[model samples]
Target: MNEIFVKSLPLKDVIANIAEALDTTYFNRCNEYILNIPEIYGEGSIRGINFLNGFGLIEYNCTLKEALKIHFNVNSIHPLKFIYCSKGSVKHKFEEHDVLHQIEQFQNIIVASTQQNGHILIFPKNENIHLNSLEISRKEFKTKIDCDLNILDVGLKKLFKDLTARNLFFYQGNYSLAMSDCIDTIKTSKFSGIARSLFLEGKSNEILSIQISDYEDDKKDIPKRQILRKSELVQIQKAVQILKSELSKPLTIKELANKVGTNPTKLQEGFRYNFGLTVNNYLNKIRLDYAKEQIMIGELNISEIANNIGIANKSYFSRLFKATFQLNPKEFSLQIAKNANKRQRNRPLT
Candidate 1:
């Protein structure tokens, strides 16, 4: 495996050190340090930027030609790290430890080395790995104005205030939806220069807040913890596909759960958390939407449309359509026809 060592701090120097180790070079964009992967090795780039509040953001978006390990062995205390894997997987290990922890996609790990013990990150070759690291320089962060009382939990407060790095902390869990949204925003952002830097700085902090909250919620009892996982997301996708494909014969929540290889309760939770509605409601939406499409075609009558979408009673289907769209199926169809006629009448000399 190829190895690169970063022996620096404040993020910018960290990227510079990696560039030197690679025998390559890096560039600066609004104080954001970026090191593009050399063409001889692979494709993509890795970049880092430091904020004034002692928080830093680093993103690795690349597909290397071979396995690689980045060894961070700074002389001083290493910054607390919140590493998130958004695309491919990566492995983590403390420089002084022997055990390695694999962080897969959609997962995160909160780590604090024991008393200057550094960190080693391993990335597999020929994989599209996109990950971000949110680092906090505790020595500087503790002195920032935003690090006030009531901003953190008792243990987290202690963790932040521990400038000596006497304790070793390692936590791994699935990242929250809110954190995912923040990251999505960061990736899709179109800004550049100072605008981009300021925007990312704020979003990075927002992601950190959500990450800490996610950690706190994870510490609670199993029943009270609502953290979503990759398994649930897979189930949700399966459920959606079944609903859309078998529209004329929709299944009950329990039946759908069985079809998707999950329990009814988990299915319901997945629908609510991912789609913002219950399973039954989502099914109804699918049916109603299909009904509208059939209605617009002007081939199926109300009863036929209702039956085509798995609804036996036309009256009940009409009522549902009215409740959701403020217009009964018949009325909506009529409105569609009227708009079509008006447009035809207004047609020009063609």
Candidate 2:
């Protein structure tokens, strides 16, 4: 029954206050703050980088030692939240729904321009979690950009029409690779100081843009595909899990479809409708993401990384890696090594 109250403040302050409540000191450099919880509190940590004008990125990767609830009060103007649960789950209830809404792994949820006093989030104990959240203050958005709001998707337009509304508009769906890439860039970028702040700001804006574009695409695709039955949705989700777990195996779409108890056409259509990617495209995206992660670990050579991800042709793997990340595998590996070395040199003597 542990509870934490978070007042509406800039994201950096929010993070700082949480660390204080947990009796931990946060490492501060430039506008970024990183908190590592001790074993008594939890395992893992929280990292956040904020822009003074009100946009910020907060990343949480932790396992709570006990169940905890968070109450967040939105005191800022035109507050918006874009949240993705890359691992584990969290639950919350909106004003309109009596039932709790769960954001599970590989899913995303967005809250737009809510005027509600606050919302509650619950985290279960001993569950490993990874969450990335982007917060935007509409005032900051307006001051930073000169573009017309009408250029955005209709869904976003309606969300912004009445900034004073007590009820918030919500959007939830499968997290897209495009959105994932933006977050990966923000997390792995080697920049520091002002350069790091600027990199995060650019990445945050890029994520917002991708969300809008994805919303528009979903709107168009909704009409074309028939509504999926709950059972079908379950099967498609199972397929996704299988695909992720079996990255090292070369499984054709037909094989995946059969394994998931669906046909090729339904499988392909279901993937596009539910996840916004073709089977091949989604597979490739996950493969490249895995390869990138391995490269970042700095424990494997480029060929080893490629082979571990099921790519037989190292040259082809490099091509796909470059296409997705805009950097060749070797170059990306070198960058990760350079960053690790810099951090090592900067560490203070114990």
Candidate 3:
């Protein structure tokens, strides 16, 4: 856990640009700082700023002496905030909506997005506020578990009790390393966008997995089937292995789970438990990954790759492929062709 300081807004801008390139409408114009929440939303407007565009999580450490400002709306939507208390207690003021509330000492807070714009605040004080945001997707989120909203406040508090010690010892002045690892996890996975949505929407599976991973590392005993359990942990590796071996075969959650000696429920839970994705999501990831490889090789047509990956419906497969890789199969093929042509032209005639 090396520590490196980062300015959040620039990172947000990079994410917004990527979202625009990917055509993610939700993050089309997400350009604002997390500290400046009001700028992200317009009064009486439906658009909310998308931090998910970056495809990673964020954390904050701050203290307030004034009441944080918030907006309100009449739309039925999701809640988007995770708060925790390390020292002083804070109060909620929502006349328009009954926001689900939680408060705990020395825990983490999570902020999720809803359908409409609303406001929330922590009691401003001289006390330092430490917060962490871990991006995740809806499918990877554990809505069925018992989660303390306040736990979202203390970033990864469930993993390490001695925040100062862990921060000082493990992080060892390399916060950027931690951030890099998180960003890499998102970039390498197919559940990239969904992970951000889940984190903002108070989805607990991502946080739980983080907690469980930390607990196991610390040699702590947890009773439930945590995400890091050996049986559960192996499914992701198995899915990846199977996907790599059978890229040309049709994949189903039931089949994959059965092959790994687990049911769909456990398979789904565990796949997302260790990785920030469900079984099906992982399958899509592999399909798309292979699609890219085939394009680069330029030995297969779009339909061939689609059908080979068990995507019989060309239109739907094309859409899913584009959504995952940010380019239609044709476009991807053309780009690869362009690169090959460029290389060939640059080669000296023998």
Candidate that scores best on lDDT: 1
- Consecutive 10-residue window with the lowest summed lDDT within model 1: 223-232
Residue-level lDDT tens digits of model 2 in 1-350 = 67887654576777787787788888887878888877897899888877756678888889998987877666755367788876899986553456687988767777753565556678889999888778766666555543667786777776655446555678877655567667667657899888887887788778777766656655655434333322356788888899889887857998987898766766887788776899989989999988988888778888887777788898999899999999999888888889999999999999
Q: Of models 1 and 2, which has the larger TM-score?
A: 1
- What digit string (tens of lDDT, one per residue) describes model 3 on residues 241-313? 8877886675677788668765666567666655679767877887888888888887888888888888889
The alpha-carbon lDDT assigned to residue 58 of candidate 2 equals: 84
Q: Please state the error at residue 61 of candidate 1 in Å.
A: 1.2
Superposed by TM-score, candidate 1 places the C-alpha of residue 298 at a distance from the truth, in angstroms, of: 10
Task: For candidate 2, list the clashing residue pairs, or say none.
Answer: none
Minimum summed lDDT over a 10-residue window in model 2 is located at 222-231
Rank the models by lDDT, top first: 1, 2, 3
Assess each prediction's global lDDT (C-alpha) against the native: 0.86, 0.75, 0.46
Candidate 2: residue 74 Cα off by (Å): 2.9
Clash count, candidate 2: 0
Candidate 3 deviant stretches above 4 angstroms: 1-228, 347-350
lDDT, candidate 3, at 249: 78
